[model samples]
Target: MSNKDIITLLHGAGGSYMHSLIKNVFMKLNDNYGEVGLEMLDDAAVINDTVISTDSFIVRPIFFKGGDIGRLSVSGTVNDIAMMGGNPIALSLAIVMEEGFPLSDLEKIVDSIKKTAEEADVHIVTGDTKVMEKGSLDKIIINTSGIGNRPPQLDYNINTLRKNRQPSRWLVPTNLRPGDKIIVSGTIGDHEISILSSREGIGFEANVKSDVAPLNKLMLKLLEVGGIADAKDPTRGGLADLLNDWSEKSGLGIYIKEEDIPVREEVRAAVEFLGMDILELSNEGKVVLAVSPEYEKDVLEELHSDPLGKYATTIGEVRKDISGVIMETVIGGQRYVGRPIGSPVPRIC
Candidate 1:
């Protein structure tokens, strides 16, 4: 290990530690990978114009209310590719297993991965496995690299999401207009709550399941109807984080009707009882689309017809004010919705 400090879990996260690791080791070792792919630091890389995304799954308490790490491993990478305006085709999986982990659990995870790949209509075209000394690794850590074909139209990168495309990777709010409508593809908060329950062993009156599913199909359908300015799954930062990123990046105000934001009643109540902001909660199988105002109804009609999009809701609309993100409170007042404050939840993605 390096002499600096004992690496923590966050190091592997797609944030600072990951960046430092890449600059120090990866970039230094393979100079050719260079600026473009390394700078992106996205879930995948684009090469020869191919859309590629990668993700490492280290979610503890792997087995959760709705799904497990196995399923997450595949969907996470595939979704990352989808976000890039690509159609997922294949994935490369890698696993680091701890010496004492159960064989049965490993099998289950592998089986789940295969199932997910099939459901997403992608294949595990390549992979590698290694066993670590006991206690060398958390039960298991999975890394996946996914490759896809870009939409024939204009290409979109994480650059569009940035506060400003020039300096960093962020959501681009510049494209959003005041009258543009916010459409949520499905229910929210299921993934976070499910994982939270598993981690904390929180008991609930009703069973909560993960909404982790392949979104490639739904994303394709949306494209069939009309062009979408933006499409993000609202995974880690939750819907609130996603919208806030958009509003802040674009310098436009956003108004979201709390009622129209889709949520399962149990999830809403559970989240409310825990005093969590539904907007700040994470989701696994949801898509947020920013569509042109004129096509809002037409898109909504077609989306509603889709079983996956049946729960589609017009949660809000972009605004002309520059106060960033705002919400019409349930009680009829308004509140300045801020990004997530602390570790209210971790490993949300």
Candidate 2:
């Protein structure tokens, strides 16, 4: 069969292939009446100050070291809304379970969902459940749709940070500019590594857990500090994909320092052992922020104060001299970091 005749896992891996599929196939159906819509390819759609985002979780193993599928579903949706500088208020959940799925496991997942919602201070106001034929589906899959209100802090940040330029209505990826500082919430590759270890039963000495948690509160705190030009969570395609997306959208260059980017020792070892690129792995609970130079210090301080961002640090700065993401290696050499065709690890949140 020809390449276009079939669908592959890469189409949903949140990398170049997925983006190409969306632009080529899904954009044909673009009928958005919102400020940020399908054409924009943003984290969420903004309609009259209401931000909406939807996501589906089919992570394998269902249960992982730091969290489960239930928590992943909630955190993913909530973080998407937060990236749009919105205050998540409610979510709609839909679950599909295969026939003969255990009732005890369902109850456990529901309890996890409840606790994660409470942690994010959002409500699960609506939901649906359906059963599929035993052989027709996996154990369970969850879809969550979230709605949030554009908080006043978003406007305040734009005005305070972009006093000389025209400010956009909401935080978008293309808002990055030259001199803007790039900061990551914490270590990368933890989530993907943890999943791999669990699924493959790799008995690593270090206990690397998935860094999965709702980051709405932490995102809001940064908004209050002001000067956040753009924000995104490094998910399916990891930090490399996120940086590439920002660079492409803004038509600017990003200079990242390999030493500045945080990666745990265990994660690094595991990646090397598996002959994989750590930058191409996924992270579920971290965010990458582009902040104006004037407010970069304040933003870092705010991040340092939060539990979710205590390890946050500046990894790079936006530039106009180059065209793509360029990383300064630890040995003082530079190399281009491009978007992966697909994540090295599959089914990773």
Candidate 3:
């Protein structure tokens, strides 16, 4: 809704276009309730200690290797609230379906939503459904809004994940500082590669599956151990966009070791074949954290204890020497990790 009269897929890719669109259009009629609004641009909005977030899912194929649009819808909203250090309590589901869509498929998708919500310890308290004429839309699209509450005793202490400096808010990327260690919850590019292989017919015999999962429990465990400065789940823009946003916001550079960042062999193979950078692809379940070195070991231990984070690794550390994301290559060289401006793959959550 900028100067252009039409909207493109890039406007929803969670990159520059999406950022600008949100700022220029939807944000113009802003009513953020004074304390919590759209300005922070964190994962969720917090008002009076309650956290809330909403997201729409239009992933192609509707069903994929490890999840469908249904699961993605729930996890997307729930994770947004959790990233803000809140325990998700409930969600509202709305669906738009094209006429002639299979009823069996709808049942399966709804079942997936129920299962994921149960696993994430939340409920779908309300919902709505609408059907469109044939060919008017895709098979189905889902929108979810979630609400949560910060712990009663949330504070800056070692037991709490909330930052002491920003008592009014919880964890945010801008809270990062130099010398803080960077950690990724698990392997990158698995979800994107899985979708590509299954949907694009670029099947890799290695069997890569989507990492579409909820990260609330994993994050809760880490928050319990404390020392975390900031956290973000790398979803739409992958690790590159997430890191670049952190850099631009904190006015600091993030140095990640290429050898230390985790990536599955199959994912790497697919990325190489497609001539794409794994860093630019999207991930659904993984989280990136900026933690203080003092508690890095403890935080890693906590993450490793969770099944979702068994492959967690300390990938890098925040730096003040520069002003952007720099990755130390395996060959002992450094390169700038820039933001992805266009959508590499469309309709990817």
lDDT of each: 0.73, 0.91, 0.85
| Candidate maximizing TM-score | 2
Backbone clash count for every predicted candidate, in the order shown: 13, 0, 0
Error of 2 at 95 (Å): 0.1
- After superposition, which runs of candidate 3 have C-alpha atoms over 4 Å from their true positions? 1-4, 31-34, 152-168, 200-206
After superposition of all CA atoms, the RMSD between model 3 and the true structure is 2.3
List ranges where model 2 is wrong by over 4 Å. 201-206
lDDT of 2 at 39: 85
Q: What lDDT tens digits, residue by residue, belong to model 1 across residues 1-349? A: 7746676654543333445666677765554462236544344556665777777787868888778899999988888777655788999999999999999999999999999999999999998999999977888989988888766433333332233224222212355666778999888888887787677655654467888878887776666665356667787657766787677656788889787788888888888788887887777787888776766887788789887788998898888855777888778988888766422665755
- TM-score of each candidate structure, all chains considered together: 0.82, 0.97, 0.94
* Model 3, residue pairs in steric clash: none
Ranking by lDDT: 2, 3, 1
Given candidate 2, what's the lDDT at residue 298? Answer: 90
Put down candidate 2 lDDT per residue, 237-338, tens digits, no spaces. 888999999999899999999999899999989888888887898998999999999998999999998889989999999999998999999999999999
User: Which is the leading candidate under lDDT?
Assistant: 2
